[model samples]
Target chain A: MRLRGIAVVWGVLAVAAAAGLFRLKYEVIALEERLATLTHAIEADRRAIHVLRAEWSYFNDPDSLDKRVGAKLDLVPMDPAHIIALDALPFRPKPVGETAGGPARPPRVLNPGSAAPIPVPGQKPATLAEYTVMRTQP
Target chain B: MMPALLRSLVRRSSRRGAFLYPGAEIRDLPGAQGRHPARVRVSVEGQAKAAVEVGRNRLAITAGVFALAFCVIAGRLVDLMALNGGEAEAMAAAMAASDGPVVGAVVARSDIVDRNGVILATNLPTVNLYADTRAILDPEEAARRLVQLFPDMEYGETRDKLASGGHFVYLRRHLTPEQQEAVNLLGQPGLEFEPTERRVYPQGPLAAHVLGATSTDNHGIAGIESSFDRYLLEKAEPLQLSLDVRVQHAVRDVLLKAVDRFHAIAGAALVADVRTGEILALVSLPDYQPEAFSGAPADSRRNRATLGVYEMGSTFKLVNTALGLEVGGYHVTDGFDASHPLRMAGFTIHDDHAQARWLSIEEILVHSSNIGSAKMALAIGGDAQKAFLDRLGLLSPISLELPEVGKPLYPDPWRPINTVTISYGHGVAVTPVHMVNAVMPLVNGGWYRPATLLRQDPEAPPPGHQVVSARTSDTMRSLMRRVVTDGTGRKADVAGYLVGGKTGTAEKNEHGRYRHKALLPSFVAAFPMDDPRYVVLAMLDEPKGIPETHGFAAAGWNAAPTAGAMIARIAPILGVRPRGPETPVAPEVRFATASGDAGRAVH
Candidate 1:
């Protein structure tokens, strides 16, 4: 009886040991598969980042900017003659305020050495106050 | 068998012994020998047989274990040699081939382009020549032939490289395809060719400051190239910027002509798409050609559009006026007394072109009165002014993708004096990019979008924020138009385009004092003011008054007329049709007045 009991205990231990060993082997295999999947994902992400950075570098190129604008805008190259200087602006005489007669009287040109004056048509004579007021008004 | 033999021998000896020996006892000798001889032999034989069986069994088990272990080891060896041997051999070969010292590797670079799929920058294929000096049979002959092929190569340098006992040495880098072919014809055993990449700029110096140039080894050193180095080095796709090449050429051409006409130290121009916040064209001169970047002077390489910050003169009046209308509740027809200079905090604010009378808000902007702007700023108060400018991105360093950006320079601790000076664009300094970006909201329906360089998906969500009221924006547009049509920016008016803009001429700060003789002339304008689309800006640095300018380097004399020429030349190219002769002028300004205020209805 005692020997039989000892044999049963030893049998249980051997079965348990075999089961544990098989489970350990399967666990190692599962872990390796997970590691491989994760590694692939990481590599893919790195490649994507690389592609985006390359795209950025390409877009900022200077020659490309010039061509697109030229094609889109119907522009011709300009030279110094195209630009006008402030001094070249034609001058205009100041205007005057309205009078009861329906309009202000035009400025008159004084004759040399004489009090008599020659009237200019379609031109209004403006006072200092009126000119200041008009100049300030938008 | 040996035991049986011994037993028989003993028996014979016992039998032969004298049984009758007088000294031998009968019970001790003769009786035992006769009874147990056969039994003793059988027991001895059985024991010997059992020992032999055990020895054989033990030997059999040992042989079985040894055979199993040997087979497993042999199978593993075959698996390794057959399954992975090719890769292992290749690795070994690579190791052997790289036995010489190594210099820097020629790494691949990235491509650059405009937003419209145009190639602005690219890396062309090139070759580098190298030599295995230890393999050279005649160093003198090799050096002489190389020198003859490449006259630029110093003879002494080539000879030293050839004679250096090292196994490998670099002969030349960035060799053209023709040069490589010529070298290959020599057929020197030690000579080898290594492929490399060289950066190429197709646009010459049109956008030199913005694109920047790379070094010989393909490392970016300035502008957007240097700023986005890591992206350029690692990314595979080309970078797409929001610049338009045609606009860049137009703006540059106009500014170049202005520079020659006015003898300006430098010039810059920028055109921005207000709706998308894309910088259509940005030009800075004197600009350097990227192809000859190394030979350019330091000043030529500086990006004035995005790097140099300056006081923008009367241009700041637009911001102040907007703030007054928005925060101070001032209407377009609100009146301000411009008859006298305003004195505050020991400073007198006066307009260079004074208007000595009570002027309406619209008139003040049209005339660009310094005193009027000061009063409006005072009405808005200091806190509101600061907040408005800050919200407009005028109080800090602008956050753009490019590395060559400048920070706004303002007085610390925002004082009243600073506020007054800033109102007239005196105490504050900002880059031209900042000015263009800040003004975008005024014409873009009050939305502020940070500029982008990449091509954006049309389906993607919008990437901007609203910074002003749409009503205020419309009002500002009208005011800008009036300035061009009948006020200070008359020179910027393009016929049939309804052009609108502001003019500025700032005195250069020299030795802590304003230089009266030197002026920085600038103009900012937008076309078809009814529904603003694009904002254009041009500036001339320290432009000298010329004969044509009547000895005046003001914005009207220099920058404004340049903008006009640029718009006229570029308008049709931008797909904007010239207005028909009968097209009515768009009424830009809508005057809001106090109810019952008696005035000739100002439109």
Candidate 2:
């Protein structure tokens, strides 16, 4: 009886191993087919890209560009007299309010040394001023 | 172990002494330990039992070995065929064997690109449609269908091709994909498509002569294409030329305008980076579209920049003056008498608008005095002048990558008349490329770098040979600057840029005699003369005098202004800064007389 029992166990193990092997073999075959299809798709994409690049260059030809530029852009060739070195550029103008006799200037800090208290995460809000209301009627 | 068993069996049989009777049968006798000893003993007829036991033992051992080997082989076979993914390898092998059209065909010819990586020439994948006439069941039907699909193809020609009982015939080549599909829908028997490459010039006729043309099989036939055919085939990388399409267009536009405005036969222009010998732009007209190589006029196909040779008028005066000063050790202040026309060997050399006085070396170039240049050449012996020109690479064909270069024409005997006329730009003919390459040394610190079509790495320059002393080059630059400031090249002077050059207006020599009306006017110029960077050369063939030019057909009126326009457009592109200060001239290089229009914009 023991020998028969052992034989039954051995037969089950053998069947399971054979079944696993077949699953692996079919899986590999399917993967290889998928890989080949993907490779073919990639090659097709490359050919499309090549054709596009050639067409791009054809359209970007200088004569065509000159025509397109003339029609589309309001640009002209830079005259030599208009071109100047960096040294020739005028100094940057003062800020809007900082200009001489134009307007009052603001300090580097808008409100000098008046650091507001940090807001607590879960604190109840104090009553806001009329002008400092956070939200207004939509 | 089997051998031992066989030995025991023999020993027992022999001990029994069964051999006493030759044919007696031996049976098992009960031993002293009577535990069924008969069951363990064997009975045999005679010595045959021992022989049989030995044979059986050898057979058993052999069978065991073979059985083990077979088991091992079976295990390995199961490992490879069943356990591992061996099918993947098999599939890979099959895939490699199959010709997958999706992978596409390899490009047979590499691309030609400009310096900025712009594609000038490329290949387009196309199909050639052909027919197997022998397999055509209905030639009339196939031809009818073909004509319907491809309207460009004639019905009669298609029918003839299909009716001919040939194995194969080319119906149409370089078919577009849409056309191919239309033909395929016909389902005509014996019709086939062969995938091939067709060369394309994206820039069209912009650089036609430079990019060249290709054969039906996509092999290069001319220009840079033919020159590097093998190299382009072996390598996949694009060959980058030194040409800048922007600069080339600018030059071509300027030249075309001049050609059209002057009613000239044709024109040519070239721009070179004097420092690196890199050709930035070269234009030749009438230029043909590289794509439309057939049915082009022969004159349009000629690359005037490098192939067409002409006696380059007073452009040679720069050569005469430079050589006269450098080789003859003459000073820039030296004067040549131009009071009378030079008469030698039945030929007279005179100025166009004669100065009619003694002119300094600078004035000769300023006025373009043919007599003055002749006197200077006479002063420098014939041998010295020839040696100088030969050193300048004017005596032989210039070494360039193009195959269509022209050989320079010079007097074979090197007679006195040849020497005198050649001095004032005659008796010799050279391609414009040679003229530009020869004059490079004048502005390039007296070093002559061979003009190149390939882009040069500025850091790794080729060791060039010295063509003249640096001091002489300095003097030449000043003299050239003076020419633009006050002499024949006055119109070429751009504001805020130092322009220096000489103008030559040579009458075309037709059938061994000079034709006065048919003139070849050219201007050779160098810009920012203080430190020259580029040399611009412009030439107009048989330009007629227009009202704007004051009815004057000369280098000063047409070619000089063309060069000026080209310079004005290309300077900003080349990163040449225009200095604000007025260009100053040296005291000695100034005109001696308070010159009138004689040395001005007149040839």
Candidate 3:
């Protein structure tokens, strides 16, 4: 009687284990399908982005802009006289209610959180030999 | 008795109660004998017991058969899952290997961009349409519809391809998405779409010669595209060039107008940084659309600035002057006699500007005296002059980043007469790029920076050797300033830009002699002469004299004024700070006062 009871218990456990294994096998197949779908979608999005970036570049071409909108917008080349030294520009006045000379706000930076030093407006730009901005995004 | 019991078992099963006895238990079953043979032994005789033994043997054989089947199945599972991971790894490797070229093909080629990241050339993903020709039910009808959809497709060609009965045929390539949709809406079987990439030029002929074009297979065929094809194919990043489209537009705009006004056959213009040797703008008019470069006319496809070698008239005077200063050991103030024609080596050398008296080296250039320049070149000697021009990179092809660069034409033997003609810019012929490159070091404090189209790192400039003393460069700068201020390049002088340059008007050499009607006029200019930063060059092929030019198709009339307009247009975009009159061209103050009198000889 004890042996029969033991056999019955083992049979039930084996049936449960078989059911779990089949469930795991199906889950693997479903996960693989999902992975393939996501990969294809990501690839498709990347292709779309490439097309959009190219179109953006096309729209911003200088010669086309000059032809299409130069006269309509009354655009003209900037004159050397229009570019002034930093000292020539007047300092911005304090806000209307802000106190002067007491705990002034820190300066606003262009590239926030970056460690590069803020450029002084009137400083001479670096020479072409000294300037390098190749492949900054890559 | 055993047979009788078997009979009773059969009768018990078939008829519900055929073997019924008073209080009889369930009738003995033959199939149950294997499990409960003890009852059969007690009820039946010795013969029945032997039959039961045979039943037991059959049961054992059936159980063994089932066990062997399960063992075989388990062994196959293990073989598939464990012992031979090698096949699985190979399949995985094959998948990974197939992935690499697909990604590479999608990149196609790196973009060609201007210095400011404006796209000059790029690639767009597209779909190509193909067909299983055998699947088409009606070739003529389908071809007609296809021709209607894609107007560029020929009806006869499409029909022929459709009826070819081939397994696969390409209908069209590089189709737009809308066209793909229109084709899909036809709902035809066996039609397929193949994704691909095609090179595109966004700016369209703006810098066509610089960006070049690609072939149908997406291989570069010309210009920067050909020169850096390998690098472009390998790298995914954009290829950055030194060209600035804004400056190029200014140059193109001015040069186009000048070419139109002068009625020239063609034209070319270039601007380069004197210090860095970076070309900012290069325009060769009669330029073609890069998108259709292969089909463009050969005349428009010629890269005039770097390919067309011509006898650059009086502009060689700048090199002659520098050569004189460097190797001839002539003082700027020393006088050469220009009062009469120079007869040397079976040639009569004379002057166009004609100052018929003793003239200084400076005066010779200011007056465009061919006789005086020839005399100076004779003193410099043929060998020394050749050597000097060679050091300036004028005797050979310029080491610029273009496949179209032409080798400068000069007398290889270095004859004395060759020296004389070369001095006044006659015998030697060079492309416009070499002219600009040769003139750069003379005014840029004498550094031989070879021209490059690639954008360079400003912090560590490419190393260059000094070709002349700083003093010679200083003298050349002042002399160039004087040219704009006083001489033939007068039309090139801008009020605040302090433009300095030389003008060349060579009678176009036909066969072995110069022609009177055909002309090649060019001007090379440097700005803010005190600290020269940029050099601008303009050249025109066979320009006719308009009424406004007073029928003078000289460099002074057309090329010089064109250079001036170019400077005015591009200076603002280049960020050159303009200033008012600050200093004189030269400190040595002297002018030839012999206009009225052929004065005393100083030579």
Tens-place lDDT digits, model 3, residues A1-138: 999999999999878756765576567557757977886777777778777878987887777787777768876766544544332233455578787567566544333332323355776534434334323333
Task: Quote the lDDT for B168 in model 3.
Answer: 83
Q: Could you tell me the TM-score of chain A in candidate 1?
A: 0.39
Tens-place lDDT per residue, model 3, B1-603, is 456566666767777754456323343444555545334434645988789888898999989998998888757654444423256457568779866322543466888888998888888888899989778889888888889898989999999998899868999999898999999988777678898888998888899988777898888899999999998898978899999988998899889999999999999999999989999999998999898998999999999999889999999999999988877777899868999998877778878899899989898888788988888998879898888989999988988887888889887687898999999999899989899989999999899999999998878777888998888899999989899899999999876788999999999998898899999999999997978989999998889988999999999999999999899888878888665522332212113322422121110
* CA shift of B501, model 3, Å: 1.1
The alpha-carbon lDDT assigned to residue B164 of candidate 1 equals 95
TM-score for the A-chain in each candidate structure:
0.39, 0.53, 0.53
Best by DockQ: 2
User: What is the lDDT, from 0 to 100, of the residue B603 in candidate 1?
Assistant: 14
Which lDDT value does model 1 have at B389? 90
> Which of the predicted structures, 1 or 2, would earn the higher DockQ when compared with the native?
2
Error of 1 at B8 (Å): 24
What is the overall TM-score of model 1 with all chains considered together? 0.67
lDDT score at residue B178, model 2, on the 0-100 scale? 94
What digit string (tens of lDDT, one per residue) describes model 2 on residues B382-443?
88889999999998997878887999999888887888888888988999999999888988
lDDT digits (tens) for residues B1-603 of candidate 1? 444445445755677644444423322345556633333323445878899889999999999999999989756654443424256457558657864212112236666777666667767667889999988889889999999999999999999999998777999988877888899898787888887777877666777887888998888888778887888888766678877777777778778888888888999998887777778888899999887788899899888988889999988888888887777778999978999998889988888888899988899889999888888887778888999998889888777667888998888888888888888788889998888888888777888887654555646624778888898888999999998988888989887567888888899887679998888888989887877878899999999988887988788878888988888877766765444222222222112322432121221
